[model samples]
Target: SNHQSWVDTSIVQYISRDRLPLTRFFTKFELIYIPIVGQTFYFLDFPMMRRHSKQAVTKNPALAGKDIIEAKRACALLKDKPFTLLNYLEGTRFTPKKRNTQQSPYTHLLKPRAGGLALAINALGDEIDGILDMTIVYPDGVPTYGELWQGKIKRLGVDVRHIEIPDELFASLQDGGYENDSATKEQMFAWVEHLWRQKDERITSMLAEFEE
Candidate 1:
């Protein structure tokens, strides 16, 4: 789901606890070097990724692609099991400032980052049963974590979209379909744009009800 506020996790987990399996989130590798929190995630088997800088990769070619490889290996352990692996295609929480900075086409979202999503698809495409695209909205106005914790949250708007993986998209992932392939990458961008358009419209409709 596209992140809107800090309380989004609590909302999502609270609402979806029974509906979906417990999830494994993709986290920054540097977190592992932190104290107990990092170790907790590491022990929970979350995918820890080192987002290498271009300069860093240029300096050490061996570091190239290492994070994705490790993430995939961790995903492999979930094979034949029921688990939720989540990727936030937008990479970061959405704010009006970021939206304007990016000149994002969608009114309520940041531009989707393709590479990390592609890596996830490449790793878990075959095993994942369906693609679940969720858009979370707080029509009462987004609340801070403190407000939510203080019981200030009232209504929430959540749209859960489930779609079968398209054959062409799946094929591309199976056969090197990420940044390296122009056609496949273009197709992915188009699909993501389509999804975002629908999601934006849904948010519009959801907000309309708030006024009514």
Candidate 2:
């Protein structure tokens, strides 16, 4: 599965080779809801990822404004450090059937949950200037984490594209209050949607190339 492939890949291998200074600001449940070994993760000093539930946040006036503030604090903790923050925008993996059922805006990816990324960017500010957009391709089929651990699945490919955020988006954030400002939030959301659209196009072209 992709887990083993991830271990074998250049990106993961390179990161593992060095004792990198990094903190992961990931989704909360991955750390909290695990069965027996969840508590052990806290020993590593990885911050407990927390995100407000969509419904709860929307309903509560106090919580509605907390996302950006919390994200800023998280980003502040990681500033000037060579750390990797893995945020899964889709919030879950994709299967072909799910893709069909969801009719996602992006052909290659599940629907992106934009709120987390928006907060991260607002928090990180100029600290994060580039993004390495990674595409994991499983020509045979998508594999589960268990399959990957057992060494049952193999033959995977990865493509990395380093994308620069357009200056306008950065400038908008720099103006301050991106989260609370309705106009700025809309602009950022539109920009991200455009990026996802392009990603869809790129993935389609790449898959066609592989087929040929």
Candidate 3:
């Protein structure tokens, strides 16, 4: 999904409450140190991932690829369970400043990351039901977490639908080619980029409806 703000987690939960299984999302490791909310996440058993900055990885070279190992371990733990694994492909919230910095091809998004999705597919291929694409738009404007609690965000748009995985790609991912084969990784990246492009257009159309 296109992440906008901290409120996205609640919105996701609200939408999937009755339809999906228990929701478990990948969270930043540092978040576990936060107050009550962090404790709640810990108690709920959400996966905590440490994302090393580029500079940090460069300095300690050994830190490279650690997140993947951690992510795989997390996915293994969830393989036998029924749960909605929510991954924010953008990796962070969207801001005009960030868009400019990234020089992203999509007008309304950052480049989508495929690593997490591939890992999930590789780990839980047989157990999964389907992959869903979720698009969220703040038609009025992106709201802060406080604004959400204050009932200040009046207009919003959310779309959720199943995403069909290409047969060849699906087979490759299920076989664990994503990590072992460079071509499979590139294919996964391309597939997700296509999804992000559609999402970018959808966001534009969704916001246009609010104007009318």
Candidate 4:
């Protein structure tokens, strides 16, 4: 669904983030934070969360067993159509201070939090064929949103790799009920871990190429 307007306004270059298009539809969970801004999103029918602790759910008498329920609700919202769900697994933009503090395993990636992705796979089950693992490299250096707007940033490299879901894992999802089946959940988790490992390797290879 490429919008011709995006290309017509000399926005193609500005819109490309590491060569990836700026606007795209997303499925799965999107965590939106902003007071007034979030309200507009809600008006448009976007899912909003108050941000609760996973531990609190276990300790509180009234809050037990809500994770599955929430995940299920999200699944219902995104069950159809091809959409891109934007998730920052690093949970935020990359910065030298944060990156060093986190000691990220991937050279250019933030450590992936697999829980959300796990829930998405469990909820969607076979509905999603696989994931498009994306890598955004800023040749000139990562730019803040403001910098990009000010026309201060230039040059970027983008790569998109489609990671195929292995048959075993797909079968596991098909046979095992997303929430109730333990085996399928474990398999999906393992698959996500494998993808993260490959991503780390790819980042290293890409950096080497950039240097050369």
Worst 10 residues of 2 by lDDT: 1-10
The superposed Cα distance between candidate 2 and the true structure at residue 109, in angstroms, equals 2.0
Q: Which residues of candidate 2, in runs, are more than 4 Å off?
A: 1-23, 29-40, 174-178, 209-212
Model 4 regions more than 4 Å off: 1-36, 80-82, 99-103, 171-189, 207-212
**TM-score versus the correct structure, for each prediction:** 0.92, 0.75, 0.88, 0.67
Per-residue CA lDDT of model 3 for 1-212, tens digit only, reads 78989898889998898899878988887898899979987887777777777799999999976766787776677776678989899888989889989999988998888877887777677777899999999977888999989999887889999999998999898887887899999999989988999999999999899888
Per-residue accuracy of model 1 over 1-212 as CA lDDT, tens digit each: 88888687777677669899877778887899899989998887777776787899899998887756776886876775687777777888999999999999988889887677778888776676777887788888889999987888888888787866569887796666765688898888888778778887888898888888
For all candidates in order, the CA lDDT equals: 0.80, 0.61, 0.86, 0.54
TM-score for candidate 1, residues paired by index: 0.92
Worst 10 residues of 1 by lDDT: 171-180
Looking at candidate 3, what is the lDDT of residue 172? 95
Which residue pairs overlap in candidate 2's backbone?
none
Indicate which candidate wins on TM-score.
Answer: 1
lDDT for each residue of candidate 2 in 91-143, tens digit (9 for 90 to 100): 56666666688887656677766666666676777787566665666666666
Cα lDDT tens digits for candidate 4, 74-188: 5466555444444444545556566589886555555666556555565567676556666555555555666666877565544566678777766555443444677777776
Please list all clashing residue pairs in model 4, or write none if there are none.
25-84, 26-84, 26-85
Model 2 error, position 2 (Å) = 12
